[model samples]
Target: MKTKRGKIPGFAIQEMMVVLAITAIVVGMAFSVLNLVQRQMGSIEDIYEVKLEANKLRQSLWIDFNRYSYVNFDERKGQLYFSNELEEKNYTIIEDMIFTEKDTFNVQLEHKAFYFKNHEKKIGEIDAIELKTSKESGHQQIFVFKDNAPATYINHKP
Candidate 1:
């Protein structure tokens, strides 16, 4: 078919197809970019969550260490218990999560580890702890607790 083009304000089939193809390409690119941005945002959120958990762990540990006369970790039970002459408090790490006594509070922490130093250590006192947490998004944090108590080391619960 002979096409006439003289200010008729019309587009041929080939031109329309080309335009549609370009539009589709642009839309596809936009969607892919959006997907990448979404993934980055999710990564950022995961990192933020990990940071919050680390802060909570540090603050809680500080309070527990100060308030109690002694603190110990039960390796077999995966529980960290702090006690004095009368009151005893405990927290258990289960399936990469932390659970506490009294209120059954829980925090999701992936790849979490706690290391303790007891009186037997050459450092002369049981006054240091290490906490490490990591996430699948490659976010990792390590917090170390120094001996600040006045020659105090709490006993582990039986």
Candidate 2:
């Protein structure tokens, strides 16, 4: 090779090709990492959604359990009826979802049980509930209990 005294040297064809190949490899690796990160983020988002919904369901049930003077479970209908002097609320479990009077909870239940005074009951008045969410939702167990019941409610039958 020959060059004038004042001229700058250019990259050889082999060196240019090597640099381009290295850049392409780096870019490909970067894209692969990005794709992997995106997939992991998607899975995390799904788990977060499930946990959020489960928390919402727990909070709602706690509130209703405390507010109602009487609680009754209908095994045949897969329903829980909560009633006070002025209002009534119904929670119906169907398939993978729970439907209340005003809202629906998209929670998949793996197990559910109703209890009163530590004894499990299938039908009629109950004071406590235990439920387990599906494995995909982290297998969360939720228990709601109402410790106090009015004398009238305790004496009466529903």
Candidate 3:
């Protein structure tokens, strides 16, 4: 084969270094973006978990509240009571009505406030009850109940 002299072609050391630097910058950016996405996804999952727990708690409250004729809360004892009638009953309301995977989620029914303020009376005839849960954050939610028709009239505070 006849050898022919030609100008050296392809990338120089400086060119290679520039390429390497560009590649490193791109990889670093990609890694940072990936990390951010993962963190956001994790936060979303936590929020979903909290919402699911709140829904379950709300459903349980609706079931118990409907079954019993009256709901009462004793602040001093931090206990909730449910009775079929004003006098007595076979089944009573239980304390700590809400449940969550996390032990810190606190659930309480304010029966005393409702009773004293006459909120139950506002419910009127007890046709049906609606439960709604709102997310406070990734770890918490506020559950609210609306009564369709309550039997008695009671006073309430703003």
Best by TM-score: 2
Give the per-residue lDDT digits (tens) of candidate 2, residues 115-145: 8777899998888999999997668999999
In order of listing, the candidates' clash counts read: 1, 0, 14
TM agreement with the true structure for every prediction: 0.60, 0.90, 0.53
True-vs-predicted CA distance for residue 72, candidate 3, Å: 3.2
- The local distance difference test score of each candidate is 0.63, 0.90, 0.49
lDDT of 1 at 2: 95
Candidate 1 global CA lDDT score: 0.63
Stretches of candidate 2 off by over 4 Å are 1-6, 152-158
What does candidate 3's lDDT look like per residue over 7-86, in tens digits? 98798999999999999999999999999999999989977776766566656556656666655554344344555654
Residue 53 alpha-carbon offset, candidate 2, angstroms: 1.5
Rank list by TM-score:
2, 1, 3
Summarize candidate 1's per-residue lDDT along 102-157 as a digit string, tens digits. 43323444544444443333222234565445544234454545554544433332
Residue 127 of model 2 has an lDDT of 88
